[model samples]
Target: MGNWSMFTWCFCFAVTLIILIVELGGLQARFPLSWRNFPITYACYAALFCLSASIIYPTTYVQFLSHGRSRDHAIAATTFSCIACLAYATEVAWTRARPGEITGYMATVPGLLKVLETFVACVIFAFISNPYLYQHQPALEWCVAVYSICFILAAVAILLNLGDCTNMLPIPFPSFLSGLALLSVLFYATALVIWPLYQFNEKYGGQPRRSMDVSCSNRHTYYVCAWDRRLAVAILTAINLLAYVADLVYSARLVFVRV
Candidate 1:
């Protein structure tokens, strides 16, 4: 089952990548393709869009649908975070490219499929970025709001000079949100992997395991500190900044190489 899950994930990732490249006009330049062929492209992309929607959005739905404590909610939040990363990575092609012209590197679609994906992706992000968003939590609210501000700034950057608008990176709103979400996923997952926790016996207390009856399998393990989540958020904040720089460097290379 593990092997099959990995295979399925790779398959989906490859399919999404192909759709992105096709939308970038990469294939057409080699084989003489055009927007005229978009019907077929759109159909394939839309199908994939539905598949993505089904897989990723469900985590968010489950996250917000009901409230639960214990390590379960932590697991759900982590799952949502992971899915967000995958969604954002797949979306980078569309986000990194500029929305211009009908075809070529400037063409910013893979169509409405992108728009639909973006909207759903955003909804998921709005919630995960602040799981307490509906609860009037100020700190988390501020964190999520910062993302919104960054997104608006990115959209503004695209509208202005736009740095050749064709050769430079055009970070739009969806792209902005997706980029941070992706980086956040990395940090959160890494922390979760390293987090140390041991089950305890309610009858005899905390820390040391009194009996073999209380195994790691019986109850979920949680991080020793809530501060781990804070640490993950901080690391991702650095990652988000680095990602923009990387995008610039990558765009510059593509222009020079004419790839």
Candidate 2:
């Protein structure tokens, strides 16, 4: 289905958000505040998040294909299928690895660095692409480029711990990464709509306006204002980077505790 189809996306978003709230919030309530407990909670949440994606992807794909759209749609269908297969492989690997059996924090450092680099790359790409994508609307171009760059830096800070790598701040990389991935999915989907909106505005010379619902006005527009199309791709890339960070952290945490 097209990016504008909120009906399909909403269900997935709501379910995942609820899962996050329960998993993260529950861990904070149940466990003592320590680095040891962090990994357990993260693993639980990551598994749940993956399970939810498994359900949503098949349902959404079937609904999308039912419309009998074009070749591009077919390509998208195939790409998503590959992603689903990859997710399943990850789930299998995670399941086979016994919990609390890995150790050593420094071992995961390289993977975390790679994720930080990826986030920086994505933000830079968005900044460079924004002007070309939304040249007709300077307001949108600036908003998207600025916000994307800012968020990317924020994510990098969170990843690298603001250059004080010695500080073992227990930020849950898996949880953050999953959240980032979900955010990326939203960004890319929105970009699909924004790209067309940008093109339409360019061809027609009309200022693009959004629907006036309060949530849409505040949250949706805020996200959409970030130049929509190119920014969306950047945001999605950031999310994937975040997910990678999470996986690295998870693996690293296991190493530290087990060894």
CA displacement after TM-score superposition, residue 120 of candidate 1 (Å): 16
Q: Could you tell me the TM-score of candidate 1?
A: 0.29
Put down candidate 2 lDDT per residue, 133-206, tens digits, no spaces.
45766644654554464457435534353233424536565444444444544553454445445433645553
Best by lDDT: 2
Q: For model 1, where is the 10-residue window of minimal lDDT?
A: 192-201
The TM-score values for the models, in the order shown, are 0.29, 0.29
- lDDT per residue, candidate 1, 58-83, as tens digits? 44343444455634654554465456
lDDT score, candidate 1, position 166: 25
Clashes of 2: 13
What residue runs in model 1 are displaced by over 4 Å at the alpha carbon? 1-130, 133-139, 149-226, 245-259
